[model samples]
Target: MGIIQDITNIFKTKPKKEQDKAAVDRREKQDALHKAFSDIQQQRLHGIISTLKELSTNEEIKANLKQTRHYKEFEEKVTDIIETYNRKLDHIDPSIKESQKLTVLPIVEAKLKELDKWCEEPTKTDKTLIWKNIGNVIKHSLKAIKNIGNKGYTDEIEKVRYYMKAVKNAKQNTKEAKEEVRGATKTFNS
Candidate 1:
């Protein structure tokens, strides 16, 4: 009877141990998954910041508006956007996984350099010069997006459209102002 009782007790203890081990493994896996998700989210946020910086520094965007009446207005708008985005991004944990930073940093740096060049001299009198430079910047931005292996083409294209509209509006306003001056001169001469 003693031997039989001991055998039953041992069987029960083994199952309880096995159950505890399995529960621990499950918890560990859950924690790992959560960590991975958090890391991915951070990377995406960084990508957003990189894209915004590229748009801010794009030379063609700057050149189109530089001499326009709305130049300051547009600059203020863009600056605000960048500041707001940066503030939000800064709230993210600063600790980034090493592998991710290695892959993301260089592409972001290159994009930023291109943007800085654009901002330095936003526009010149040469129509073709401004558009051509802008086209090149857009191409470079697209390439960076590709290198990052993300899907932001639509957003990027929208950014191009925004600048294009600004250029077009500036040109129209300049034309209207010239016409107004011409009318005033004709009246004065009469």
Candidate 2:
């Protein structure tokens, strides 16, 4: 029985060439996206990455942000907000990866989930509120940064303001790149 199963498994598995091709395809897609994002945008994406990093631990969550029954709605709302942010980022730099930047809504949801888990603990504190506030600031920062094309940064928290400026810088870089492309495409006929 073992010999027969081994023989079947060998035939079921895909060959190395096919797997290699798939891997190459994935890399090409990733590179294409990365190439579309300019150097400045990439720099901004990497810089200030810490601001978005999770600060709240599971042990910190004293209670759920909402009732268990509302998890679905909470999920949808988080996803919508994240997708909106991603859309704005795509406008600024198509190559930028929100997931890696931890700007993705899913990452935010995961942090919230950790908060929920902490909420399960009998003992509770203000940490839940703090995490929620931080999450809001993060989301607001994304929205405000999206507007940096015209409005620029606000005089809010110093850390968030710095990241907002980075967003503006990225937008400026994208704008300049677009102008350069337009200039290159323009034709002067004799």
Candidate 3:
């Protein structure tokens, strides 16, 4: 009966990591959307500048506009949009630089370096010891990383580490799958 129960547990459906997947998906989508919007805004500003340049180039149009009452209003409106977009562009660069700097994760980097140094020599005696070693690594990681924002959820370091762990597992699985596929391809071609 215990053996049957253990077998059932082994085949049991695990809970989905909904938060982790949603966060990664949301961040990627938001970044792509912001880039697209920035591109569109840049194009619109360039189009406005081109229009203003054309207005300045034509003698008749310039003379007529200078004589008209609406010319000052038109000039002000166009100039305002140009200045507004200029200000927007100016503000964007510094913020981007700041955010890029914030993604450093200093403590995380240190811990990763430590792991690299430790992993340089194989010290595991058995399978259980290897699993315990891995758990300790994760425990230290959770403690080392205090916090990381930018995942759209300003969650704890533990949560962020969970996301990274999930990604690492996925990447490992993908690499193994590719290797298997390549091996199979060679066999089939032969």
Model 1 CA deviation exceeding 4 Å by range = 1-14, 67-71, 89-190
Candidates sorted by TM-score, descending order? Answer: 1, 3, 2
lDDT of 1 by residue, 8-82 (tens): 998767687788999999999997876775565446546546545554576755655475554574356446545
Error of 3 at 67 (Å): 3.6
The digit string of per-residue lDDT tens for model 2 on 79-153 reads: 444455456456544354433443443444454445344334312333333334444445544443443323443
After best superposition, candidate 2 residue 56: deviation in angstroms? 6.3
Candidate 3 lDDT tens digits, 25-137: 99999988776655543443344344334444445444534543444644554455445445545555564743433233342344444543443333343222222333343
Clashing pairs in 3: none
Worst 10 residues of 1 by lDDT: 97-106
Which stretches of candidate 2 lie above 4 Å from their native place? 1-37, 54-127, 148-151, 154-190
Q: TM-score, each model?
A: 0.39, 0.26, 0.33
Cα-based lDDT at residue 77, candidate 3: 44
Global CA lDDT computed for model 2: 0.46
